[model samples]
Target chain A: MFRYLVRRFLQMIMVFFATTFIVYALMYWTGGDPIQALAGEKPVNDVLRAQLTKEYGLDQPFLVRYWNYITDLLHGDLGNTLVGRPIKDVLADAWPITIQLAVIAIVVTILFGVTAGVIAGIRRGSIFDNTTLVLTLIVIGIPSVVLAPLAQYLFTIQWKIFPTTAGGDASLWDLLLPGIVLGSLSVATAMRLTRASVSENLRADFVRTARSKGMPGRRVIGIHVLRNSLIPIVTFLGVELGSLMAGAIVTEGVFNIPGVGYQLSKALTTEDTPLIIGIVSVLVVIFLVANLIVDLLYAVLDPRIRYE
Target chain B: MTDIHVSSPPTVGGGRHLLEVKDLFVEFHTRDGVARVINGVSYHLDPGETLAVLGESGSGKSVTAQAIMGILDMPPAKIPSGQILYKGENLLAMPEEKRRQVRGKEISMIFQDALSALNPVFPVGWQISETLRTRAGMSKKDALNRAVELMDLVKIPAARARIRDYPHQFSGGMRQRVMIAMALAMDPKVLIADEPTTALDVTVQAQIMDLLGDLRRDLNMGLILITHDLGVVADVADRIAVMYAGRIVEHADVRNVYKHPAHPYTEGLLDSIPRLDSKGTELATIKGLPPNLMRPPTGCAFHPRCKYAKAVCTTETPLSLDLGHGRTSACHFAKEMLDGTLR
Candidate 1:
């Protein structure tokens, strides 16, 4: 297990470097001059451009510039945005909101989704199963972009139940609407995956054996069926965690919540290369860690699964 | 063969049978229609007696056992009318809670495929101990200790060391032993082993059968061995009940049935076994497929596959005829077959 962890950590480092390099290369090769974007209304001149290029290491070769970025990144320096604000400061201000939204959304998605799925799977073909299936389908079919605004309109503009947009002093109640909108698709996906898994486990011979062992129906479903079905659902949730961070971009926009995703969109408009790279690197690290945790959980959920 | 008869003495406990099935009928509601899977299946099991319910696939041997165990899915499977009497109490008439108490405590089952039968995610010991914990209300520590003891009972070597191993880690034979251990954990009065050795090797098959026979004798439990292999049950089974298309065609002492099969299906099954003495000869096989239960033939389900099937066999369903000494055959020409008057 230690060897497995070491290997995974090494793989994570490799992925981190690869992703950062790709983001850097894409930003550079895309032909948008960060210095010019920063200059705004200022007239272009050789001295100013040269000073800006030298300061950011854009004057150096791609490898050298990337090496400098990596070295600075190791020392906890995320450089600066085109607007001359420190990327680290920007992230420090935005990350907590995104984390809060993602955590709440993920928790709600898993809790409600798995409960509904287990019920539907145990009583397969029943009215409850049919209803959940149809509801999840409808939720999954509507993209978050459409669903988010619709939810914002319903909960805020029309119902007046929630504020139109969250403020700096936003509480859990303020985060609920945006979190639900962001988690809607994931809830549907988790429900369907869990339903399919639980239904399949229900048909497994072990379940029949459990029943024949005189296990009560509730224990049989809970301990045997649900435990077995959780493997796939956990895996899905891990991947969904990464997608949820990405999905928060549109969700944040609709709710006007100041999160990492909101900052990412703002950076994209201004071509803030450093801010974009900082946010992307953080998201990549989060995604990789989630995947690693999921890998560890596999061994816990199933004894037959072992890592050497 | 003489030892086979001698090993199974007449029910030593007098008329107090462990289990008795009376006119048990099971049907499945499928898209086609209601499939009559088990039609009037009846048998009685005595303590320390091994009754092998032998038949081809789809002959309702497993289904009948499932029905008795109360494990069949009710929506698809329905017991229209029947009595599964355990200790003289009709299980069918009892509430689900009462039936559940009898299931693992008084009567337990070992399924065919042990790999699938045992939960893949859990240790074999945990699976065994789960029954002890839930049904017997044993503490976790006590149940685990009992699990190791049961493992030793099934002859799994190094029980303490291997108790933590998952089902997939055990070989087919070892896994089947694990399943047997699990069933025996509750010390049930009746153990229904459904093709327990079917997934095992030839040598392992003999070993499992030997283990089951010894365990049954030691525990004095009524063992219902369900199998399609005629040769496997011949030595271990005290009595053999041969079924064809959901109906028992012959029920007699194992030795008697082997010596003179009163039903053609039973004869065909015996003949199909490749004998070492008859090397280089083509193995005899039954001609046709087992009839579909959805629309079984009007008269006898086996008539189409029986070589000696007469016009009466095709038009009239034969009731079980008593031959002396509790031997019964559901064939019109059972006397003729027994007397060697019919080919």
Candidate 2:
């Protein structure tokens, strides 16, 4: 198991470098000059442009700048943004908010989505199962872009249950509405995945064996069926965790919650190369770590799977 | 063959048997149609007797065991009419909660493919001790100790150390031992082993059969051994019920059925067994597939596959006729079969 972990850690390092480099290269090639965008209505002379370019290390070749960024990252220095705010400070503020949102969303997903899935699977083809099927389908059909704003309007403007925008400090209460919107699509996916897995495992011979033991129906479904069904759901949730923390651009925008998505969008408009690369590099690390944990969890859930 | 007359099995209120399935009919309401699985199948088991329900795949042997165990899914698998009487009480008419109480306590079942039957994720010992803990209300430690004792009872070597191991860790034969151990944990009065040795190696098959026979004698538990292997049944089973197309075509003492099969299907089953005396000869095989349950043929379900099929056999269903000496054969030419006159 230790050997497997070492190998996986090495692989994660490689994937992180490759993904961050791709994001860096794509932004560099596509983005307009940061200095020109910063200048806005004012025209900058050649000497001032040169000074600005040198200050931001833009005069260097792509490889040299990339190498410089990597060395800075290794030394725990995430360079300043085009607006001159430290990227580390921006990240430090945004990451906690996003983590809060993601955690709450995951709880919501488990409470409603997983519970509904288990019930639907046990009582397959029942009215509750049919209702869950239709509801999850509708939730999945509407893209988050439309769903987020609609949720915000319903909860905040119409229902007066929540504020229109997140308050300063982004407390658990402030982020609750955005968290549900961010997790709505995932709830649908988790429900469907869990339903399929549970119903399939119900027919498994071991389940028959359990029933033959005269185990009460509740214990049979709760302990035997649910344990096996959790394998796929855990995998989905791990991957979803990484995406949820970084991919809440629409929900964050709809509720004006200060998170990675909001910072990323602001960086894109200003062509803040360092901030974009910094945020993306953090996201890459998160995705790799989540995948590693999922692999480890697989061995725990199924005894047949050994790490080594 | 003995000429003495033996009476039919006692139905409910007549007398007590360990377990009796009488005129049981099971049908599955599938999308295509209602596929009749068990068609008026009846048999009985007494203390220390191993009654083998012999048939090929799709013969409803496993389904019958499932129905008796009270594990069949209700809507898809409906027992239209039947009385599964346990000690003069009809299990078919019993409440589900009451039946559940009797299932693992009074009657328990083990299944084919032990690797699949045993829960993969749990330790083998935990699975064995489940009924002890939940039903008997024993503590975890005591239950686990009992699990080790049960494992040793089934002859699994090093049962103490291996109790913590998972099902996949054990070999095929050892896994089967674990399944037997689990079934015997509650000390049920009647134990049903459904094709227990079908997934095992030939050499291992004999060992499992022997274990089951010995356990039956030791516990004096009624054992229902379901298998298609005639070779596996000969030594262990006291009586045999030959099923074809969801119906029992013949039933008699094991030796009588082997020595002189009254039903054509039973004859075909016996003939198909490979023997050293028949070296270099092409093996005998029963003709035609088992009938599709959704649309079974008229008359005897086995008529299309029977070598002695006659004109009457095509249109008239053969009733299960009582042959003397506790034997019954559902064949149009049952008398000729017993007299050795049917060619």
Candidate 3:
């Protein structure tokens, strides 16, 4: 098992580098003139432009610039934004909000989504099952872009039940609505995946064995059926956690919550290359790490799966 | 339902057998139609006796076992009418809670395909110990120790070490041993083994049958061995019930059935078994497939496939005729068949 983890760790590192490079390359190839954006519509003097370009290493070739970025990354320097704010400080200010949002979103997904899924699966073809099926399809169909603002309008503005926007001092309470909106799609996916898995495992031969053992119906479903069903659900949640940590731009925008996605969007408008790369690099690592954890969790849930 | 089949002479006090399935009728409500699976099936088992239920695929042998275990999914698979009696009490009429108490504790079951029957996630020891922990209220350590003992009882090699392994880690025969150990955990009065050796190789099949037979004799438990293998049934089973299309075509002592099958279906099954004495000849096979349950043929369900099917056979269902010496055959010409005068 230790050897397997070590191999997985090495693979994670390789994937991390490969992912960060691709993100960097994509940004570099598609980016507009960052120097011009910094100059703010004024025609820059040749000398000033040259000095600014040399300072930021914009004059260097793509490979040289990429190498320098990697070197600085190894030395614990994330460089600075176009406005000279340390990218590290910017991330430090933004990541906690996104992490809190993602954690709450995942908890909500598990508590509500998995419960509904298990019920729907066990009582298949019931009214609850039909309702869940339609509701999940509806939620999955509506993109977050439309759902976020509409939810904000319905719950915050019209109903006046939730806060309209997150204040500067955003408590977890203020972020709750946005969290649900951010997790809505994943909630649908988790519910459907869990429902399918639970229903499938419900008829499995082991379940009959468990029942034959005089196990209570509750434990048969809770332990035997649910344990086997959790493998796929956990895999989906692990990958979802990484994306959730990256934050939902629409959800953050609608709620006016300052988070990683909000900062990333602002950087996009200003062509803040360093900030973009810094945030994306962290996200790449998170995604790889989450995948590694899921793989490890797979072995825990299913003894039949062995890794050498 | 046959009166003679259900009215077996009681024990000294007029009490029932250890386990009795009386006139059970099971039907499956499917998209196509209601598929009649078990039609007035009746049998009884006594302590320390092994009753082998012999049938081809789709003959409702496994379904009958599942119905007794209370594991058949309702709605899709429903028991229209039946009495599964344990100690003279109707299990079908019992409350779910009381019935559950009987399951695993009083009447446990082992299934075919041991690898699939055992939970894939738990260790084999834990699976065996689970009933002990839950029903008997044994401590974790005590349950585990007893699990090792049970494994040893079933003749699993290195029981102490192999107990911690999962079901998939064991060979097919070894896995079946693990299943047997689990079923025997609570010292159940009635142990239903549904095709216990069907998934095993030929040599392993004999070994498993032997282990089961020995265990039944040692524990003084009633063993219901469900299988299609007549060869496996010959030695281990005291009595055998041969099923055809969801009904018992013949019920008799194993020796009697082997010597002179009263039902043509049982005769065909015996003939189909490959024998060294009949080498290089085309193996005898029963003609036609088992009838589709959703739309069973008229009269005797096996008439379409019976070699001696006649005009009356296609028009009238045979009664379960009581032959002398504790044998019953549901055939119009059962007497002639037993006397070797059918031809």
Candidate 4:
């Protein structure tokens, strides 16, 4: 197990360097001069511009700038933004909000998705199965963008229940609808994945063995079916969990939430390289961390997957 | 559902015949539509008899076992007619909850593939203990202790220490042993083992068969051993039921069936096995696949494959011919077969 962890951590380091280079290349080609954005439309004076240029190393070679960035990154330092704020502080402030939303969305989806899937699989051809299939397909087939506004209109404007936008003092209910809307895809994914897994497992020899033991349908579905089925569902959840955090930026924009994604859009418009890089870095970290957690979960779920 | 071995687990009272399956039928609603599978199957288990259901794949041997156990999938496969009576109680007519209680407590089944039959995620010991804890109401500690004891019953080596190992950790023979141990955890009155040793090596198969024989004698539990291998059934089964196209082609005492195979299908199967005493140029083989159930032949299902098939065999299904010497054959020309006139 320790060997597995160490090997995974080492692989993660390799993934980080490869990812950093790719993100760096994309950002560099986007053609933005960070100095100009920080210094406004015009230089203050020729002397002031030169001094600022030298201080920020803007006039240095591109390779030199990338090298310096990597050097700073190694020392646990993310560079300052065009607005003169430390990249780390700005990123840290927004990171938790995004994390909280993503985690909650995933948790809610996992609980409901897996439960609905197991029920649907066990009682297939029943009304419950029909309803779950219809609902999941509806959520999956239609775009979330369409659902987002329609939900905001129906749930917020007409019913006057949920808040239309994310607010400072927003309660859990306030975030519930948008979280469902943003996570609607992930929810569908989890549900469908869980459904397929459980249904397949129900036909497994062990399931027959369970039934032969005279275990009730419910216990067979719950203990024998769902537990084994969740392995694949958890794996899908892990991959989706990362993409949702990144994708939640659009959701943040749509819902007007002050999360990393919200800041990222604002940062992109203002050409703030430091803040954009910072947000991407945090996202990358979360992606890496979530993957690691899922790998560990696989080991726990099936000891056969244990590295040792 | 013959319960000839039902001595009632030593001290338990005589619970009727222990199990009786009468006129059981299962039809599958597949993509091609409803196809009749088992047809008017009837059998009973007394107490300690090992009744072997012998047939090739798709012969409805496994289906009958599944139905008797009430484990048949309902949508795709439905039990339209039958009475599976355990202790004179109709398992089919009884409430599902009542039948469920009878399941792990009274009857248990060991399936075909041992590797696939045991859950991969759990330790073998835990799986055995699961039934023990759930049905027998034993605590985890007590259940686990008994699990080791049960493993030892199956002659699994170093069972106490190896109980912590997963399914993949064991060999095919060992995994089958674990499955047997799990089935015996609740001390079920009737154990239905479907192709138990079909997946094991020859020596391992012998070992498993011996272990089952020993365990059956010890527990006095009725055993329903399902297999197509005639060789394996010779020593273990007290009685044997030969199935073809979902019907029992022949049913009799094991020794009688082996000594004098009444039905053409049984004779064909027996003739197919190579003899150690006399070496034939080529071992015999029964021709053709078993009839398709969707549109089975009008007469005997085996007639199309029977070498001695007659006009009578094609036009009418022969009523079971009672040999009167504790044997039965479903064949039109059983007299000819008896007289050694028909090949």
Q: Each candidate's interface RMSD, rounded to one decimal?
A: 0.9, 0.7, 0.8, 1.0
Measured against the true chain A, the candidates' chain A TM-scores are: 0.95, 0.97, 0.96, 0.91
**Which docking category, incorrect, acceptable, medium or high, applies to candidate 1?**
high
Backbone clash pairs for candidate 1 read none
Q: Write the residue-wise lDDT of candidate 3 on A116-187 in tens digits.
A: 999999989999999999999999999988999999999999999889998556899999999988877888
| Tens-digit lDDT string for candidate 2 (A1-308) | 99999999899888878887888789789877778877876899999999989888888998898889988987989888877789999999998999999998998898888988988988889999999999999999999889988988898999999888994487789899888888888899999998999999999999999999888788889899999999989988988988887858878877888899988987877777788999898888888888888888889988989988
lDDT of 1 by residue, B185-206 (tens): 8888899999998888999999
The residue-level lDDT of candidate 2 at B257 comes to 92
Q: Which regions of candidate 2 deviate over 4 angstroms?
A: B1-15
lDDT of 3 by residue, B1-343 (tens): 0011233355455657888899999999989899999999999999999999999999999999989988888979999898988777788987788788888878889989999999898999999999888778899999999999999999998999987899999999999999999999988888999988888898999899999999999999999999998988888999999998889999999999999999999999999999999999999999989999998899988888888888889889999999987799999999999889887
For model 4, how many clashes? 18
Quantify how close model 4 is to the true structure by its C-alpha RMSD in Å.
3.6
Better of 2 and 4 by TM-score: 2
Q: Choose 2 or 3, whichever is better by DockQ.
A: 3
Predicted structure 3: lDDT: 0.90
Q: How close is candidate 2 to the true structure, as a TM-score?
A: 0.96
Clashing pairs in 3: none
Candidate 1 — which residues are off by over 4 angstroms? B1-16
